[model samples]
Target: MAPKPKKKSSKFSGGKGRLSRESKPVKWIESMAVDMIVTLKKISSEYYHELPNRPDAHEARLFYKNIPTRRNRYGDIPCLDKTRVALIDARDGNDYIHANWVTMPNARCRYIMTQAPLPETTADFWSMVWQENVSLIVCLTKIFEQGKMKTLEYWPTSCGKQFHQKHGHVHIRNVGVRNEPHFALTLLEAVNEKSMERRKIQHYLYLDWPDHRVPICTHNFLQVVRYVDEEIANYKGKEPMTIVVHCSAGVGRSGTLVALQSLVGSVNEGQVPQVCQVVSMVRKQRAMAVQGPEQYLFLYWALTVHITSCCQIPLEAKKDLLKRLVLMKNCSTKSACSLSPITTDQPDAATSSARQARNEDGGDRKRRPSNVKRKTPRGSVTVRKSKP
Candidate 1:
């Protein structure tokens, strides 16, 4: 006789027969999460050092070879010419910007993953937004990090600022700017100088994400994702609009956020999430998405947190599993580090407005919570402790 299958060591696994109604969904999700994390960790460990070498599609190689592509901020990372988005010359102009259109099959989600806009490329960036009829722009990196300029201030800070470009000219006005605990919302109005026509766009600048790193708590990030999806569902036009997302390189942080969003989307649809599959699909569309193992691991944590929050798992039970299933993984490495415990709270409007004003006046300094202080070096998992 064949040997009996080994008992699955999971929180939900208890000499399985039939599970209780409440326990069934939570147990299924928990088991699925464990398997997903193991697979991701294995994949990350094997490919942590470098991306797998794969030949580019023929047309993409042609663009890489023949087309005049702009030099990326980092010489090492280049946008594959084949997947790069080209300007609608007949409608916009001849200049092409470095942005790619990525769509996920299961999630039915689409994104324009582009690099942080250079000063010269800012106009082209706006041009692409206008031509593509993009309704949302998700900025994942800070404009400046450690006194180095990471991304340009592409949008008009104040209302009625005329932004001029070689191919097109438009007046960009900031209609409203509201800052929440984790992210900022800026409503923009763009007026075409030639036709005097106008359009509205929403910009979400997520502040919690550190440069070249992942957030300690995924709660706020999930809130932002939910907020964006809810807003996208309200689009009035017939053609679905694309959401533009970017970080400094458009691969690391940007990729992580997109991958997490895709996984969460699948889970919300009552399907088990496959983290590695989502990451691989995204990488195929862009390149080097979810850049490192730490980031890859982060997607799992964010998804787990989401499941617990949605499933109404008891705080003690959630905490126990978090300690056992999530924190058990060793995250410390040269490029990655461990984070402190997570805190989850509902978003407050008044607090958001106050934070916005403070941010406007003092910039990043005011954004740091006063009761907490960073206990780790840069590029590591920063731990924040409350003041005694």
Candidate 2:
């Protein structure tokens, strides 16, 4: 029979070998992960040939140095001399090239995503982390929570409360690996406190959507609707609310929201195509990755909520609208002509007569000539106009 494993103790610690360990946990994207184990193995063995001078170690550059796959080994990659930065090329080549070290500015977003539960914040949090200069923030989890003195006081704030009040309450959640600062664990153990640093209210309950209620005002149209009835009394701005959305990738959630916004814009303006075109323009700017196929189909339905509005393209009500438009256009054109002083002393009668003469000449020029054959260099005969 196989011998049972001995466990760790004061005298002898058997490490992982002693423990009856199981297989490794599945990773989200194993092919692209720059795991701690691999990163360690790499740094320990590689040569850090000194490059006299190079901020050259920025995230985009360093990312390519340590290749993960044996089949796709990379050499001739410029050596990284700088600290706190590595280059990570996103366009082509190995994906995990810049896994570990990276430029401080570029690393901030990427590093944050690597650690445990995604970081969440209130308005105070958003202000600090927002990088207007580089719009594409490396994907990272952002939490929004209200109330404080909770266990996860480790929960950092990026934006301040002022920015959040107008939008809605702040909340957070983790899909898996309930880390030490677990939501449920924090709620039960921590005391809600109000001190020199933290805010007053008890933390709002963590929201788990789909498992919970699908949010009613998840999209901007819903927000506008809420505003129309004075639901969002303090809401400012007639312009569309800027919404940030991501579901692993910004495509799905963002596309859905943009689609709904298009729907709302159309309904509000009573012009459906106008909104459809608007959504199309946005998708062009940022990929409809938000729409991928599934969400795209749904977005089609969502935006078409009031399709009848766009169906006929509003045929000028009683045709009187067209007439009025034509009359207005004619008047506007005449007014423009009238505004310009006559450059030459052409009498009105002369002008009318000149126009008549031009018209007569035009009619003569437009007359059909008799069909005739003409000799050509090639001795070819074909239909031809008689010599004028």
Candidate 3:
């Protein structure tokens, strides 16, 4: 044997010994990050561009026939008739609301995606909530954003106050409230004046989300999803409770939240998360879901962060990947890239410490003030009458 060919070193082996998978973990994380970035770019540029626009006649006939006053907050957004949520008991016999039922394949729960209740459509909004037996409302937009009224103050602002929608025959009482730094949880009791029936509802108001952009903190966003899931798990209703999710126009932020929640659930169940497919499915149910390339990219970034933090990945590898992810998210666009020393709101203590270390290394030192407000005390219920 010609001096016996030197034994080839195994890629899986380290110097003089077999290496555990954890060895050189950054390499593995790097590969994963690269794959995610590539997938996001391909989907954003190709598949997202090719999505068919909903036709006017068949898909959105009612949307067009509805009076201009009742049309969507954004004039161009279409609500597909096939999946539109009709007001079953509209006193005026006009059953249109800019809302749709978004059901994901193999999902246990369904979502009612709707625009934030317009001042004119508040009664219709309450009608749908009562008819659909919706117990959880996830509000993604603030009442006002950039000096424009994004959503009407549909719910009672203080504890013990009731918002009575006489036209819809619904009375919603603010029973309790728990305010957090990023969101507020209000316990509401919805009563049907017609049937004298009462149902408990939870309203989650996410205040940090910007009007047209994704939330800067993925961890906080996920916390909202977790809270929603917990409420769903604890539900004791006889029928399946549909979740009501809304932003201003009920497409971008709402869609992102739905997609994120679905993917997170999929991952927790040991299934592979398909971001592009999930988003496409959501858009089919609700037109223009995940509105921009930034929001689309955010789904990938958020899912990656979830995996690195929650899964059984090596700790060192997870840290490395997260740092790289922050860079990727911050530099996803030319405008985003111009900002120096990007900081992300990470969940775990390790990640938080790492962020602190990075901040010490010449990052922006100014901290954002917490948006949490004191919760109003529960007191005597007072109903406010509004003109129909």
Candidate 4:
């Protein structure tokens, strides 16, 4: 009998049959979508619960002991000493403010995450901005939300109006204001009175994000992120500028925005979007980033929209996957909507190893809420509390 002939294997086959070149991309996208869905489930059920808590040793000693009057907006949310940005020429040698330097992959000291300035700290806030040469400021909260002061008015409200901080001799004048759909843009000129040096600053206030809850629409938030990037690229500063991002406590909303930006940068660089890893990295620098499960899931959904658009996935497929993910958000329990595992290509070994290492280090730890309410001062009315 003649020997049986061997069949040639196809590059686009998984031992089932050969796929056309066009079908290959479709299969790859489908596989990626499935992996993302699984990752989302893990985030909701396992990974989130296992995130590391803020180390106890990184206490804000300056805020508590030396400068007790610095007045942390949130008592529990400490500004770790390792990452805190100190003012170079602070008056009376008190250089502490509730801000931390947050770094992203391939970008060093890219963002200064900060709390909204109180009446007393406003001058120090402007001083930090001037010293850092910040060209862009992303404000995630309004001055008042739910009739409570979420953040103090840190900039001049009207064009030509000036806010002068005598401590650093920093003067900020509002040059222009423009309103958009979900955000407002204000152009401000910061002048150092001593040296007569001036710097143009763009302040972007996002108005739609509710306290403690994710934005209603992912597209709106994504647009805000892209707009900020566009403004950064247009900057003509003498050196690369660090972006200042703040909300009430500077952890929840600020962290979410930074995390999304980091993930978008990673995707743009042709790397897979690792939601858990990105959040972990941010929290290591600034604690309690991506505050709750909802915010964490929002990151994944936003990335889904971004990745599908970038890869040009079929509209119908994208719609179906997004619809399912959205439904998962409303489920009462994490596993209420069961997603069956798909037999497809696995992610590269490097990604798998990184995830495994993160899990091991996490070790069933739970994130602690840092926004605890402090006692109201004498003769002051009690304000309703909300998340930042």
Candidate 5:
């Protein structure tokens, strides 16, 4: 006689559960109705743009869980002062950071950008740039991000549980995308003891997601971009700074970020074809490691949404944008790096005015309650701390 099947785990199995023991793609709730608000910010010369109004997605988009926020205005410093690809490897209790910068040519010649290496000196590099100001920071490594490779060995078509045990996944979603008890953590307060002025406004992107627990995963990666744009509005001078994009390997996601940046430049610099062309060039330099046709299709959809989101071009103007998209091709990365620093081009009339206002309102520093932190529970569980 066949052995009896083991009893299935509870649906609330410590904040995680399979849709069914039978095995299938995890069920997803479409358009779950999250309240996402949009607001305008002056980038220069009264040139205003619309963006999300929160640090991470709509207040309701947290998958019914609270996202982990910082305490005492510390912890990874968010995007405000970081110059481009500022690395953040805060695992369990261990904290680490690294950043890589590169320049893809536009009208700005001799641009101060170069390719970034994997896992460099985070303490020294990010610290130096964080203390200063930069127009934008780019992550060069994200150009050709091939997702983490697995052996070509055939699988027995068993359960994910067994598959998971064979491979070690450091980032596990439990209390909040990731949670593992550790003995110690290096306090951010102690590291950068002497705090400097934070730029306040910044941007970021997440690439590949080999691990299942990443709060910002493949389908939801766009949320990171949404949140960065939201937090930027409150920044002093409202001047948006460096944007860092990464994936498991930092290639595909980074490429997407660069491509978007190039598209935004089309609107900001008022140079249409040039900006689009530049983005195409970057892609050629780094092959997109996005899996099969579905992911590629997602790219097309994402690019359209991203461009319209930044430019706010009316639906009427989308026809021309669509035409441009059709003509665009892969970005070239051969000589993509190895270029001199380009001169910092000034913003146009409208953008410059907005920058001035941000400067006038800049100096004041704001910090949230030192003890409070946005909690993101694993699976769908939200922890409610007792009110003080």
Candidate 6:
């Protein structure tokens, strides 16, 4: 039998031997977490190098047969059939698309990660959106990136314009469009003319991300995430909705966004978010959820920044806190003093206790005793309960 694994003493510190799934960031109250910024940085650096390589692409072999029809930017990476999205056909029945369902059971977030639709697959993409009842579409790539076609112009760019694909019998009409510095919003109505049913789909195109890397500035990126999250919550439905997210190849920037949303959503839900654990979970559902070490590191940096922002620590206080943290780290736990030796403006425990005692004695000298009755209103009674 395999020997039992050794347990880690600190979750923020990198672990020993093999990686553990349940390992996560330490849970601290909102106020206490500001002190953990140093620890967060340390763990992020360590964990960035510790992430496992992408598992062998066992599904790669299946892509060659569908190369003519599929539009994956990377030919070597194909969605696994087990998790790949399937479309029902009238005659052929159950065709596969280069999309996977990424579900985070704990945070209650689900996403369909797909490749940039080719001109041919654009119709099928809308068909999937219609069938799946997707509430939001998160497009991470532009129509052109690095002077190459990164993503097809799948949606109608102008309001009151209509696009139809005869092959998939999909009709998309743009009703409204809104553009912002961070993202563009398009209100779309998808019609399955065969059934004569219409569905409203919200298209969100994130403008700043690169083809294979994270955004240079995370602020706008996070704003895009918040927009998607708010739209998901605002959606009115009994069934949970799936947000369709795609980039060039569907694994690199796409995975990064999905993982970011998952971790950030988890943090918002009062959970200590674990980058590796969340990435691992996403990869289980969609292979290579976080494509490389850079993307992996970005996830940590983004989370750390997000958490620090939520703490609302002033710039000066942050520097002071960091200095104090350095002092706490430099001091020895086995020192003569039980508490930290770091000097601070706040009074020490002994000083605080003495001050409290003095205040109590002064109150005793000035106060009326409990035996002396206090006046009460005519119609109301007053009761003073003794302190427990």
The residue pairs that clash in candidate 6, if any, are none
Model 6 scores what on Cα lDDT? 0.58
> What order do you get sorting by TM-score, best first?
3, 4, 1, 6, 5, 2
* Model 3 CA deviation exceeding 4 Å by range: 1-30, 35-40, 50-57, 161-167, 332-388
Any runs in candidate 1 off by more than 4 Å, and if so which? Answer: 1-25, 32-71, 90-95, 159-167, 328-388
Candidate 1 lDDT over residue span 45-131, tens digit each: 645544443435562553354344453555555566656777663233344556677777643335789888876567678778877
User: CA lDDT of each candidate?
Assistant: 0.60, 0.24, 0.65, 0.63, 0.28, 0.58
TM-score of each: 0.72, 0.27, 0.76, 0.73, 0.33, 0.68
Return the TM-score for candidate 2, rounded to 2 decimals.
0.27
Candidate 2 Cα misplacement greater than 4 A, ranges: 1-234, 237-242, 274-276, 304-388
Give me the runs in candidate 4 sitting further than 4 Å from their true place: 1-40, 161-168, 328-388
Judged by whole-model lDDT over C-alpha atoms, candidate 1 comes out at: 0.60
Write model 5 residue lDDT over 1-388, tens digit each, in one string: 1112222222211111212212111110001112111100111111112211123323223212211421111121122112233224333432323223434442121111222322332332334334333322322222233463311111111111223111111211111111112100000111122443333212121233322122122223333333332223333433323343443333344545454443333333333323224434543333222222223333433433333333333444444443343322111111111111111123322223223423453531322111223333642323233244
- Quick one: best TM-score, which candidate? 3
**1 versus 3: better TM-score goes to:** 3
lDDT of 4 by residue, 275-327 (tens): 78888888877877777788877776666555554444455655676555555
User: Candidate 2: deviation at residue 356, Å?
Assistant: 72
What is the alpha-carbon RMSD of candidate 3 to the true structure? Answer: 13.9
Worst 10 residues of 4 by lDDT: 364-373
